[model samples]
Target chain A: MLAKRIIPCLDVKDGKTVKGVQFVNFRDAGDPVELGKQYSELGADELVYLDITASHEGRKTFTELVQRIAAEVSIPFTVGGGIHELSDVERLLAAGADKVSINSSAIRRPELISEIAARFGVQECVCAIDARLEDDGQWRCYLNGGRIPTERTLFEWAHEAQERGAGEILFTSMNHDGSKQGFAIDALRRLHEELSIPVIASGGAGTKQHFLDVFQQAHVDAALAASVFHFNEIPMAELKQFLADEGVVVRQTCK
Target chain B: MVAIVKYNAGNIYSVFCACKRLGYEPVITDDPELLRSADKVIFPGVGEARAAMEYLNATGLADVIRSLKQPVLGICIGMQLMCRHSEEGDVDCLGIFDAPVERFRPTSAVDKVPQMGWNTVSANGASDKNCLFEGVADGAYVYYVHSYRVPVCADTIATTDYCGEYSAALHKGNFYATQFHPEKSGSVGEQILKNFLAL
Candidate 1:
């Protein structure tokens, strides 16, 4: 059986992790490679590093950081944020990123998904959707890291992105994000039932139960969290053990 | 020297990085001579079979790859292409292995087409002694991401059951292939690579 994945997402800014990620063992959250290594050791199945800083110099630093992490960390890692063109995708892949996640750029130009999928295969491209539930009981998609709103609905955009050759969908509920309440279970389940590709649930992960609920109830392929892992609030190894004891299948690793 | 066959496939850089992590500076090349003369050749792939074969054939690397005398390891699509044929696009592949690749048919809704994530892989028959698996414990988890798979057959060395029992690793003489990516599989992966390098 394929094990459910536990991913630790790092929001990078100005060449350092900007999410106030302070590990108990490692005081500094700035070094991506060190943090990535620690997460991998703690049983993180994958890592997602989003370069929130969209500057040319920031990109250079992100690429260098990816190279350093790739050398030491054995698990797969993804690089996202500011990926607009095919060359951007190519550059990241060449820099040693296992996959590339596109959010605002993909929403603006859906064709970019097929282009990258055609060039680098579908499995390498991930479509990340930031969404918020409106009063109409419908989820509306957002752009620019949830600061801007779009007319497109979450279901419609997710469907289009998959047809355009996105291998997986990373759905983040803006309402749930940073709330530490939990994931948007109903929304995630609806998306999972609709899409043929794998659906990853992000945003609003407060406890190990949150991960369990998303995986068992929502049926998401993976669960991603940031601050909880960064601040050592939930030790990754302990979380996996908790999930495993709760009857969720996860990859067991040697520390 | 370790040479990774460069045929416009995906995840080639990850393979290169894995080699570098093991303290060997590998070269990525498409030149037939370079691939043939290397101590070991790693054929990494993550692209369409038809297009990849087209590139290999056009560049004459296909013939060179088939004739290489050194130990050649194929990863993911690289492993599929080594088979007699693939149903992905009804394209013919290098007939190094006797099996054929088939697209996975999900038995249920939860059985995703592209089985992505970590899964335990166990050796079959004498594969426990197969140099590629040396120092690797049985049932160790390895990372795999693929939509199509080669059914179990004579060349099957290690097996992983996802949807069904399929070829996780295949060995026939000097040619070895794995549907899983050892480079992306962490510690168990590093051990597998070290075993391959020692070979």
Candidate 2:
């Protein structure tokens, strides 16, 4: 059985985690390595570090940050944001990332996914899609921190991503961003019904029941949250226990 | 000294890092002489079994590994390749253990194919003391990410439930294999490595 995953996403800017209420009004949270180690100790299924900074700072700092976090935590870590090519993937893997996520690069050159998949295997490649619900009731693909919209539709992009050999799809809803109402259940249901690859549902998880709704109703493999976890609105172990009570098979923390 | 067999697998760095954490310097190489001369050999892999076996046979490390008399530990695909045969490539294995690796068949309503994430293990009663599960509890959870699994056999030291009861840890004389990745499994995983090192 594939156990449901609980991932805490940390957005790093200038090597410091900056959490916002709704992708705006940023506030300094803590250090990346310290937060990663804390999450590992708290039994997080996985940790995702996204470099939210878009400056021309040298790559040395980000690679060093990855190394520092990998040294502190023994669990699987994924690094994303600013990965442009095979060399970027190689650098992060060499720096100790278990997986590399590509978003805008993948959108620009879909072949990059296949190339990386062939070299490092599909399990190492994760395709992140940020989709926003259009006024016409269609999901449009967004990139560059949900600032730009591509002409591609969600289903088309997801199917092509899988065809290009992505092991998993990380789907984040723009409309649900920091809404905390719940996940975009309709979009998730459509993706789960369409694609065979493992789908990780992100964005808009306000309460414990929201997680339950996503896991039970949406049938997503993993659920990711940022503010909820960073602000300690919900304890991970307790959430796992709650899911377990709901008959969802989650990785229980060793007592 | 610890020698980790390097055959283009993904998890070699984690294994090397784990050794460093244990106060031991491990050499990652595919050379036969270095592997045979090491106090213990760590066979770590994260790719397909056929390709790994192909690399071993091409490098002539297959014969060296089969003839090694010291303790040897196989991790993940390394463990799968130690069996009689693997379904991944229909390739013959090292035959260190009498078991055969089979693709997981999802019978229940749950999803099929890759069985990822963590699960608990229940030890077999044959051994009063388990070498890998020394400090680990009976139902402790360990991280796993694989599609195929080895069937339970007489050599199984610990069993975990996924699609069904599968071999979590297997032992035959001095040869040991684990389907889970101890290097990525946190504190309990570290203790398992410590037990392996203490051996």
Candidate 3:
């Protein structure tokens, strides 16, 4: 049976680990490599290192950091943020990153999705959509780390991304992210219902029950969180136990 | 030293790292001499079948791979290309195993095409047990990410259920193939790698 995945997203900035509240007020977390190694040991199914750094030098550093993590850690990981073209994807994959998540640039040039899928199998490109629920009760996709809004709604963009050869959709609810209340259950349920590709739910994971809610209610392929796992609010093993006891099929790592 | 056969594929870096983690200085090469002489050869691939076949045939490593007498392990697309044929590109494969590869046409809407994430593998009746899964438990979880799969056949040593039962692992003579990524499978995968190294 295919088990639901648990991914710890490490937001990397300036070659160090950091997490911001709603994409602002960033604070130092720790070294990304160390944090990744810890997560791998503590039973993280996969890791996502979002390179929040935008500078040219920052990308170079992130690529080098990818090599270090790949060499030391024994698990799959996805690298995102600052990937603008095929060359960026090539460099990151060459650096040993398994998958590359594309956001703003992909929205700017939708062809980037197909290009990546064609060159490197479709399974390698993850289309990450940062969306927020608007006043009209529609989820609007955002760009530039949720700074700017796009005309494409969450469902439409996710459907187009799937048609364009994206392996999966990483939908982050801007309204629920950092809120720690729970996941955007209703929006996520509709998104997965519409798209054929696997959907990885992200943004607001406050408790272990939230993981259960997203998986049971929405049937997402994976659930990802940053602060909950990073700050030791919910340990990976204990959470996995909670989910397993509650009857969610998650991969249990040996202690 | 173990040799990781390299062609026009994406990310053999993790395979190299996995071998390094097992304390072997595996060489990534298309050079026939290195691959032919190595203690073990791991043909790891992640790309389209037609292009990969072209690269293998062009470099003449395809024939060399067929002649390798030592244990050879194929992963994901590596396992696909080792089969008789693939529906992916409608191309002929290495024919190391008699099985043919087919693209997944999932019937249920909920069952995704590219089956991603961790899944369990059970030892079937292919043999009492495949040596590759010596220490690994039956129904042990491993990571997988692919769009194509091989249906159950006589060569199937292990089977996994997606939409239905498929050959998760196969063995024929000296060649071994898996539809999952053991390098990224964490502890269970580490044990499988240790068993392969012992072989």
Name the docking class for model 3: high
| Model 2 alpha-carbon drift over 4 Å, by segment | A20-29, A55-57, B125-129
Report how far residue A129 has shifted in candidate 2, in Å.
1.1
Residue A135 CA displacement from its true place in model 2, Å: 2.3
Model 3 segments more than 4 A misplaced: A20-29, B124-126
- For candidate 1, the lDDT comes to 0.90
lDDT by residue (tens digit), candidate 2, A1-255 = 457889999988888878742212323236788778777877788889998777758466788898887666888878998999999898888777888889988998999999987777667888999999899988999878888999988889999998887878999999997999999998887787777667889999999999999988888888999889887788878898999999997877675
List DockQ for all candidates.
0.78, 0.45, 0.85
lDDT of 3 by residue, A1-255 (tens): 899999999989889888632312223336788778778888899999999887889988999999998998888999999998999999999999999999999999999999999999899999999998999999998999999999989988888899999998999999999999999999889888888899999988999989999999999999999988877788899999999999999988778
Candidate 3 has a DockQ of 0.85
Taken in order, the candidates have interface RMSDs of 1.1, 2.3, 0.8
Docking quality category of candidate 1 according to DockQ thresholds: medium
lDDT of 3: 0.89
Tens-digit per-residue lDDT, A131-182, candidate 1: 9999999899999999899988999999999899898999999999999999
For model 1, give the interface RMSD.
1.1
